[model samples]
Target: MEKVNYKGADLLAHRFEIRVIRHFNNAIEYNAVPFILTEIQKRSDDFFQFPLSNGLLGTTIVDSAVTVTINKNIAYEPRRYFTCAHELCHVLLDTEYIRSHPGIDTEDKNGLPSSKNSSRERRANHFAALVLLPDTILNALMMEKKSKSYIRHQQKVSYETLKYRISDFIQLRFLLSRSMALDIASAFADKDADPLQQKGIYGFWHAAEDENISPLSRQQIAQKNNDLALGLIDPMVFEGCK
Candidate 1:
């Protein structure tokens, strides 16, 4: 996945990203239904769960008080949980948009970015993914050598989400060597242990070539990796989340 440019909604999501993670004690995954319920209750907001059309996931209505409604028809627990988180993003971050729109913001089955969705929908999706799978926790998992299957099961996220999240970080954010990135991504993705090795000599030569990463950046990455291994880095700290 290519790097998404930061937008107004992205900035708003970032503000609460660490807070949401800390609220869950940096757990890889938890029951988002209860978490979101607690959040809405804390704000004196209303929450409802009802059977809805299969194509609809959830909706957030901002009127006298914010009300979030989820479709009980969502069979997959993970998807249901994710929908709750996505709606929570709107309750917390879309105040201005809600005021202007003055109606219910409906979320369809396709919660992620799409031509049919609005920017606010995309922002909500971004917030849910960021809070659920933070960079710090993901890095810690990598340092602990956790497998992709384990992460997917533990994090309650789909394989596609895990792959894209790790790929985006390794390829764009961390700027790791191509072979190394493939190794890390594949390890998490539960693919071949070493996909590059299957390609033989060219793969070996490509892996050998320097990526020309700056010495300072390399040193910083090394330090952070070490800290993650040692469990010294605080996951609560924002550290300019990418």
Candidate 2:
């Protein structure tokens, strides 16, 4: 699998955060559906939703007018919200790729593309996480000693997403290894048994692994994540590559 353009994803998510606040009268909470619909309207695009089966989460179609279709069968409101944001990321960020590819960009049950090699899918997932739970908001919550349940309930994101976001923050902010970060995040998220071992959380964290994949070292991962967090890297470096 190709490397995900984390800097580019961060920049796009930050811009969307600004737009959400501006468009919604300084609203910080991103109501994914309404914001997505408003963005589609601004771009003169079309949107649809249907109760799809077979593990389909959403699809982005790029044609005369870009259309986003989401699965209404996602019974969990948080999962539905995440699916909407994930599809919207494709519409807004992957326009050129979608146009060139000329087919459906479908998300699986996990709200990610079934193809593991797709860096676009990974980037979109990261973008969805960042846009929904921005760094500043998460930082403030952490500073206030807010419990993971409180934060998760207030943000309306899944435990899996919350764990990943918290781990990402811990890794970047504290320059810690992935394992260390996950350990800390697990403590914050669930004081009982290890929640990281749970089905979705485990798979989501390691789904990109392959025998041929050379995992980045802790130092490298920390530097990259911190560079993006601290605005030390230019997002344009990833402009045409991703």
The TM-score values for the models, in the order shown, are 0.63, 0.70
Q: lDDT per model, in order?
A: 0.57, 0.64
Which pairs clash (backbone N, Cα, C closer than 3 Å) in model 1? Answer: 148-188
Candidate 2: C-alpha RMSD after superposition: 12.4
Name the lDDT value of residue 123 in candidate 2: 77
Show where candidate 2 strays beyond 4 Å. 1-4, 21-34, 190-242
Residue-pair clashes per prediction, in order, are 1, 0
Task: For candidate 1, give the lDDT.
Answer: 0.57
Q: Candidate 1, 37: how far from true, in Å?
A: 3.7
Using lDDT as the measure, the top candidate is 2
Worst 10 residues of 2 by lDDT: 201-210
Q: lDDT per residue, candidate 1, 56-89, as tens digits?
A: 7888777677777888888886687778777777
User: Which one wins on TM-score?
Assistant: 2
